[model samples]
Target: MKKLVVTLALSLLGATAFAQPLSPEAKTRTLETLQQAIARRAFVPGVDFSKLPDALEKRRAELDKAEDMRAFSNTVNQVLRDFGISHIRLFTPAAAQQRRTGQAIGFGLGMAPAPDGLAVSTLAPGSHAAGVGLAIGDVITEVEGKPAGNNPTSVDQDGRETSLITVKRKADGAQKHVMLLRKPYSTIRKPTLTWPAPGVARFTLPSFTNGYSQPEVDALFAEVAKAKAKALIVDLRNNGGGLVNNSAHLLSLLLPPGTPTGCSVTRQMVAEYKEKTGKESSDPIEVAKWKGPDRKTTLRKLPPYQGKVVVLINRGSASASEIVSSVLREERKSLVIGQPSAGAVLTSIFAPLPTGFEVQLPLSDYITPKGVRLEKNPIKPDVEVANALPAKEEASDPCVLAALKALTK
Candidate 1:
């Protein structure tokens, strides 16, 4: 089977990807395909399959009124929200293409909600935003002469059109206007390693998504070994997760071989479990114990890291990141610091639709080795420290300071 994916980030298509409105027949076909896929494949716990038909029917008129692919996708997503679960999404053809290619058209600015406006949290290397003097901690106050909302993409432009953006600089509180054009840029954020204190190594994994070089990871681990670091801090504050294999590989570096990390409960496994146990409750422990191949185990070839470890997480850490944090806490007794992790863990896959769109549906539910269901149950940190605001420098980051204190103590 292909590696399972767990991510909340959705790739959106450029303005040029929008096409004419869907025909009546095409809309009907797309809705039916989406409904069928949900009924057959969605296995997230507490999902009501019976309500799906009515929900789609109720929204049929809205879908019919959609002017283009973007509008159609927006309405379809409303139907999907009825499940009240994560990982259920509709990707436009252009977005699907971007996902496959790992490229997106944008100014390459990562934004966060700020009191004044959207704060620039990160700038993609060599991106248009970075090239145009857009720096981290800059607050975007206006976009196209309109107030910049909380969303990061408020400054985004359609196609190659230039968007006029006004930003408040963090250094001097000076507002500056710049024109940004949307162009294809790589979406990959490579992992970084740094030493925050003596004998303490901080490894920041921006994401576990595809395109990360394994050799680069190996080199980082080599650096850790070379420094003879006594304490390792794995920073996954904004990691939304990616391939399951990537998480497993990272876990193997810190855990023993054949260690049971967790289990993925699928629809078939749930059915078989019900048949044998004769129980109706969809509890995690019962479902996870079903005799199947959904169990996750670590495989560390070299000796595991023999040092104190700390996992830093926040509201954005999700899916595979949650899995890794849970394992490190339970098995290795690692210290977890920062805010609670994002309670969005599920194994999902993208399937193409008749209208050239892709539907992402959860195929399995995840449960920790101790029977803790992580879907809605977030992993609370041992030391709950709020992350510093985007405008703050790294030296003022409370989470890192907390980790360093614990390590040094």
Candidate 2:
């Protein structure tokens, strides 16, 4: 059985190394290594790793025909899908580099699923997409002359290359064409804080990873307190999860003392506990220690805003994002607005395969303070505000508007 909940503390740590294509012998070794790692480290229990060799043997014929890294990885990924769990994804060499550096060459645009096509869900102010008149709720109709939705997340623009993007504006059913230039991923939009209203402070957290440091958060909250903000709206839409510790620290500023955010269980600690005690104990004292004493509690006292704390989330919110949102809503009494979250709350670890690609597998399970497992059950918002595209101004974002309305009432 898979572990039902992710822990309160998550590492979300991944490692990568360089390697060339694998030889026939190396391919077999890599498969065996991956199988062993999954059996030993994955949070999914009741999987007999001893039978892994036979499983590999049966797939060897197909795997042996893979001459390149992509082919091999695709084969392994298909096999892993049998586990029927999220967070078990493989990255090719190029993808591994992109993941490690968080770099990609494309126009700064964040996309999400739309009814007709990939919609422009996120457009950083002054970004290429924004400068070209791309607005939220615009359905991308074509990319590079091909129909959109082929590669919604990526545009293979070579150095300084330009790609033509066509979108249909939801406002008046008008078609618009825009040229997007390829740029470094670092040039993407970053988190920003603003005073949308006299007493309302909104923090748009675009991502949870990258250089999103604690000091940055400290400075933001300091400003919030200085402004005497009466209402705080944490907009976490499209913020995929990053480090669990970072989210925990963010919660520390808002949550009361002794609040239990959640708990984690790793395969390594489980094995160690069984080896030492000759038995497994649920919430083993030893495993608890690995999570550290500081991680178990929230002690920081934030400003006495005493005002409405509204969180804005959507399907793009996931992992650590979900963790922080759930804790604030469940324990801190904050109002959650917008759609449900992505429900990707598992803790994954990335390791290098023989082919130099990286594979991220769920290494730990987590549970919320209320014993809710966020594996597949996303956090439903108290106020379900659907997407209202083609807003004339940023302030008109449906989620933000909903938060402000909730705060005033």
TM-scores of the candidates are 0.88, 0.78
User: In candidate 2, what are the lDDT values of residues 1-409, reduced to their tens digit?
Assistant: 2223332211111112222365787676777668766776666433333555666567777899877665677677777766655677667776566655665444666666666677876665544666788777788888778777644633432223566878899778999888876554432335678887897988877666665677778788888888888888988877777766678777776766677777665667667767876876555234545443324545655542455689888887888889889888878789888889878777777777665656676877666766666877888989998783324466777777777788888
lDDT of 1: 0.76
In candidate 1, which residue ranges exceed 4 Å CA deviation?
1-21, 157-160, 289-296, 388-396
lDDT (C-alpha, whole model) for all candidates? 0.76, 0.67
lDDT of 2 at 15: 17
Which candidate number would show the highest TM-score if scored against the true structure?
1
lDDT of model 1 at residue 85?
A: 80
How many backbone clashes are present in model 1?
A: 0
Could you give candidate 1's per-residue lDDT for residues 37-103 as a string of tens digits? Answer: 7887777765776688888789878877886777788788888877878888887877777776667
Candidate 2 segments exceeding 4 Å error: 1-29, 45-68, 123-133, 143-165, 177-183, 187-189, 267-295, 301-306, 388-392
